[model samples]
Target: MPQRPLARALTALVAVLTAAVGAVAVPGAAQAAAAVNYVALGDSYSSGVGAGPYDLSTCLRSEKSYAPLWAAANRVTSFKFPACGGAVTSDVIDSQVSALSIGTTLVTITIGGNDAGFADVITSCRFGSTSSCTDAVNEAKAFATGELPGRLDRTYAAIRDRAPNARLIVLGYPRLFETGSCGLLAMSTYKRTILNEAADLLASVTAGRAAAAGATFADTRPYFAGHGVCAAAPWIRDVSGVIEAYHPNADGYRYGYLPALTAVTG
Candidate 1:
């Protein structure tokens, strides 16, 4: 409106606009960072239960789970932490999710162990006096052989619905039995039979579902070889530190999990 001010304003505007266009024209001018939205969904394994130092309340979530590990490894920008301990197929499918950010780019999941009640099966078999967890081990075999495929399918579909565009990766459970135990007081006979079958079942089932869902399935079974119940360099070290109880140790997680992650994120 004023004569002198109008002239100065026009001059300043021209300088600002010119600078902006110059910045754009420059090659490799430090582009904006890419946004990575990762969503995690699953049970205790995914939640990293018993990983220590993390706060695990009702759902028993963990900050050190493979989900976060992969996120950190790849430098994920955004995350929806929906994973919790004891989650199952039914919970994932039926529950209303509050944490998912729309248009998420990645997701990682692991389930079905709770469904199989595999932990209980292990305990029950161990508790038996005559046989060293043989009957329970057989049941684990059945779970791997029988129930795993369907569970994987159902869980994959649910994730697809929630984040259809996201790159989904489902993880297989680690082994829990040893092939050549001393036929000891709690774990013997059909040595490691239950864990043997479980590994196979989890790998096959998740791989199949991942194919159908247009996602990736990371096979950790091979990475964990010789690390089961009686393994010398067992990837999965139990709570007891001697006998294979459940869950992969820190070494197993890094070795068994990292490859799977790089497969998808890379």
Candidate 2:
């Protein structure tokens, strides 16, 4: 894939300039036609880590990432995709400030997965016995219950301060559980339980936090609900798409984020 462009920042210069006194302007003397300035800020799930047709080398950014997909679908004019792999909530606080320019109309974030260390949970579930899966669920919940809110608060505050005017949308994690039905892999009962628990944690934490922030939180779990391990039309089919055990698939870009597009743009 082509070298990733410097993550674009939203800028409202046109609005500022046009409003200034004694500014000579176009004949229409009209407000500038503001195209949606969208910035996607988050981690691997947001970056489409394993969901690639494999194009870019650096940052391992996926071309099929929801950001590009949404942009094309909506005819978005300005877009910045800074989402990379391994982003924690703290990373969101650090990088998202300058990511927006001036006319930023929309922002979508998918983060907090790494904080849960979901990959390790999967490994423990896959390699260990039923008891290990129970341990994983508890450990995962500890993050969601104990740490997710704090991380979410910081992330929300940072985004709000950085792009106060944009319509921010927080996304929940996708359902990656395989409860004895995935044709791809006979995911152990423990493994499925852990995966579902992780998804639940992410959803509850993000949904509550985003609501507090007055941002839209799109819950994708429902979209993928019936399609879990036992369902025939599973939302996410790729194993590694689990990103060590429970993230979305390239199909997730379709299943998981389209609703986000509708919500944010609406």
Candidate 3:
């Protein structure tokens, strides 16, 4: 119906005010979300020690590492790889945490194994007598239960302080041996059993500390089942070299560690 001029003017003004109110009600809805800034930090495991074709020789940073693979797959805004081989919790607190910042949205780490003297324990188990292997594993287990937690707490706290908003995922080591006999070269079943127990202890300690720090724990043990050093299709490398021995191979990173991480992140 034909309305008065004043009435039509008032109706137009009301429509404009309603549109203004709607704009004020929702803020930044039209703006895009922030991009993911991922920073990978920790020891060789995080640095991709076993995953070869390294991009950085010093840290053994490999393109095949779960960090890079995830970053590429997710198309993160930034990816920082500062994790070095043989890095302990101290090394991470001292050197690695520098890569993180408030903008970092995701962080992943595998540490505390070195602090527990992983290399020495493996060496003792491989070459020493069963008694020596047991002793070494016992000592490592003791240290892991005693001192490693504090170190991990410090490291995790440092990471949180640096990247306060990041979702930190702490990846754990798997049992290295499958037990039983695979060949003469394989260590004794007794040694294998103890070592697996030690790995379990470390995982427990690390998981507890991660929980204390409000971080997610990614356990790779399940994924690496039936894929230890003496398994038919082992993901962990046998003592082929000095550096790579007792470490996860490329396949381990791809199939085991990567999936474990993905499960937790999702």
Question: Which candidate gets the maximum lDDT versus the true structure?
Answer: 3
Question: Candidates 1 and 3: which is better by TM-score?
Answer: 3
The per-candidate count of clashes, in order, stands at 5, 11, 0
* lDDT tens digits by residue: candidate 2, 112-192: 877887767767776677788778778888888888888888888888878888888887777776575455446666568
Off by over 4 Å in 1: 1-32, 129-134, 137-148, 181-186, 239-245
lDDT of 1 by residue, 169-255 (tens): 777776665677543453554545655665676667667877887877777766666766567776665547322257666566666
Residues 85-130, model 3: lDDT tens digits: 8898888988889999989989999998889998899899999999
Task: Sort the candidates on lDDT, descending order.
Answer: 3, 2, 1
lDDT of each: 0.68, 0.73, 0.89
Best-performing candidate as measured by TM-score: 3
Q: What's the TM-score of each model vs. the native?
A: 0.76, 0.79, 0.88
Rank order (by TM-score, best first)? 3, 2, 1
lDDT of 2: 0.73
Global local distance difference test of model 1: 0.68
